[model samples]
Target: MNRALFQKIIFAWFEKHGRVLPWRVKNHEDAQRMSGVRETLATYFTKAWRRDPYRVIVSELMLQQTQVDRVLPKFEHFIKRWPTVLDLSRAKLSEVMIEWQGLGYNRRARFLHEMAKRVVEKYNGVFPQTETELRTLPGIGEYTARAVLAFAYGQDIGVIDTNIKRIFARVELGVEANAIPISPKEFQSFIDFSVPKHHGDPWNQALMDFGALVCTAKSPKCDHCPAKTLCIAQRIAEEYRVKTYAEFLKTPHRNQQKKQSIPFEQTNRYFRGRIVDKLRESPIHMEELRMHMETNHGLSSRKKFGEIIESLVLDKLIYIRGSRASLD
Candidate 1:
């Protein structure tokens, strides 16, 4: 496939259909007036945009394994309260946890708190420019570090998230998401090769939107997909014992049932979250806390109950005295 042509197709679609997420505040409405050119992400956004690296990190941390709809209100309220790394650094862990009620992955909240503190204390509230330095912060991983670089700093790096992975597996590798042939390291390298210079921000964002809207997990809109012409999966349909797109979609990912999501209400995760949530109100007697978990949440084993409390203590989300447990 021609790299230049691939980029042209992807970008043309994005000029028409890219999302205006809260995290990426580029002026989509201004594209047409400006001859359909998307704005590049700078060190800080335009004054009208108000997107600093601080907003980028906060939104990124909150968005880990969490959806946009859930994170939007929380993200807004969060930055509104603590608009800068300096402000977040001063907040108590308990206060941050309280503000992080609805988002289930509680450790991410703690990590965000620690990350803010580190940024303020070590770097004087300035985000590091390099990926090596950024990864030193708590909870900032491979994908996140590059995301900050591309979306916030406009660096030319690939972010191989699940959406991008799915797109690549289909369009590049002619495989389904569940059956990629290479290891993560190799797949990342393949993704790295796809990023175009000077426009990696829009390019990566375009792939993400294309995957989410067109090249989706189960029901990809192959007929309407702009890259359907170049999608290796479609081009090689006959090789998979299929000749039509409809049959090709069924043949490749036939067993690709979405993993059944366990209800958050029925796990230790639920109790762990509830323990923090209950503690946010006030301290409670140890016995009363046990009773609440067992009675309300159907906690069966006393040993499991003790483990939950002990784990929360280990995680420093709570502290226990003689007969009471409270938020740390």
Candidate 2:
């Protein structure tokens, strides 16, 4: 494949359609003019926006296992409340968890808090620039480390998120979707090779935007895709559509059923969220907790509730004091 040509096509599409997210840095000169600041474009983009590692850290952590749409408001609120690593490090974990409500996966909130403390205490409030140094922090994995390097440090590194992985699987390997347990090392090599030199940040961002808006997991917009002619998955999907249509003509009544989702109210996660939400307001007795659960959520299993409370306490998410339960 002509990698340069591919990069050109992707970048051209991105220039027209790249997402305007709050975390993304805007045009430096325009922003400076608007703000009436007398700083150079280099200083504004490098120092004020892209180079601010704190913003990258917070956004990347929140984006993990969460959708961008759901994260937008929470991210804005979080950054507004705790604008710096020192602010976050000094905050109570319970307060962090309270702000982290509705974003589920409460463990991430704790991890972010711990990461902030580590950055403040060990690094003296300076965010690490290298991937190796970043990996030493709590919950900093390979993907996140590389992301910080590319986005914040302007390093020519490969960032292999789920979307980028899927794009590679389809465009390079001719697969409809990436299979489970993809080999990270092999895929990383492909991405590192394909990423244009000196254009790592925009290249990675464009690929991500294309994957999210055009080449989605469930239903890709193949007709509107810029790389349709070059994409093997598009051809494969076309063939599959024709075959499926023929089969449907033969057996129109045998349509496949959609999978059913488990009820949220019946889930342990739901109850855990309820427990945390309740405690966010005030500490309550176990009896009162049970009553609220029963009355509000229609959950009547006292034994199950007790088990969940015990589990939360063990996880250090909650504290129990003389039959009263509160956030840890």
Candidate 3:
């Protein structure tokens, strides 16, 4: 597809079908400036939306390995509670962890808290606009660093997450994403070249919304996809619509094992989360925790459960003093 035409189609679809997310909301100035642009609706809508860097970091950390629907409420509550980086920096780790209930990933809360403190102390509560500076912060990885640059500062860069990689694999590489693994970094150069500097903000948002709502990872709505005409993997995706998850895994192109593993309830991560959930209510004795684990997670014996507790303490997620353990 022609790069300009691809952008045109995608940008138009975005104006029509873009998601209404709280974190994506534009500030008063952006809204006012956007409202005054009389060149063309496409020109107006194509511009990147400006956002508070604080909200962007909060939403980005909360959305990791979690669904949008799940993050929506939690993000709102968290922002209301600690409206800025300075506020979050002042909060205790234990208080942050407690507010992180139902978010599953306790470590994310810690990272967010630590990142806020660094931003407050080092940068004086202002997020650096450059990717190099942002990466030094806790929990700020490659994708996150660039995402902050693009979404928060409207930098002329693409934010390549899994959804964008899937879109690239099918639309540009002529293969279903499930047929092989897709790495966001592999296509970073292509996306950066393709991304229009003026519309970098809405452009990345459009691609993400397109992937989530239309060209999804499973059972993609190819027939209804606005980019189907340009997508090379449309027919390939349609061909596999009848296959079950097991069948997809068993296929030679899948590059995955078909055998099942232990249930999530039996995993150490699940038990760790269980222990965290218990600690959230209040501090408890080690024996009581053992009994709680036995009653809830079906662990009747220690079986390295003690090791998990010590590990959590070592990770700074919890603190241990004598027989009692609690969130650090």
Top TM-score: which candidate number? Answer: 1
Task: Identify the runs in model 1 with alpha carbons over 4 angstroms from their true place.
Answer: 26-51, 238-247, 252-328
Better of 1 and 2 by TM-score: 1
Q: Estimate each model's TM-score.
A: 0.67, 0.66, 0.66
Indicate whether candidate 1 or candidate 2 has the larger lDDT. Answer: 1
Candidate 3 segments whose C-alpha is farther than 4 A from its true place: 27-48, 178-186, 235-328
Q: Report the lDDT of model 1 for residue 98.
A: 97
Error of 1 at 328 (Å): 54
- Superposition error at 38 for model 2 (Å): 19
Error of 1 at 31 (Å): 18
Looking at candidate 3, the ten consecutive residues that score lowest on lDDT are 253-262
Q: Which stretches of candidate 2 lie above 4 Å from their native place?
A: 26-49, 180-182, 236-328
The local distance difference test score of model 1 is 0.76
Per-residue lDDT for 1-328 in model 2, tens only?
5677888899888877777665664332343344544333233224423546777777888899899999999987897788778999999999999999988888889989999999999999988888899999888898888988888777877798888888877776555343422345535655777878777777888899999987776666766677876775555445545333213223422222111223567666678778899999999998999899989987798877886686567557899999888886
Candidate lDDT values, in order? 0.76, 0.74, 0.75
Residues 1-328 of candidate 1: C-alpha lDDT, one tens digit per residue: 5678889998888767777665665322332233344444332123343236677787888887788899998986886688678889999999999999998899999999999999999999889989899999998997888888887777777888788999888887676777765556546656776889766677788898888888887778887877877878787665555554446667533333223223557555677788788889999998888888888878767887886686567556799988999986
In model 3, the number of clashes is 0
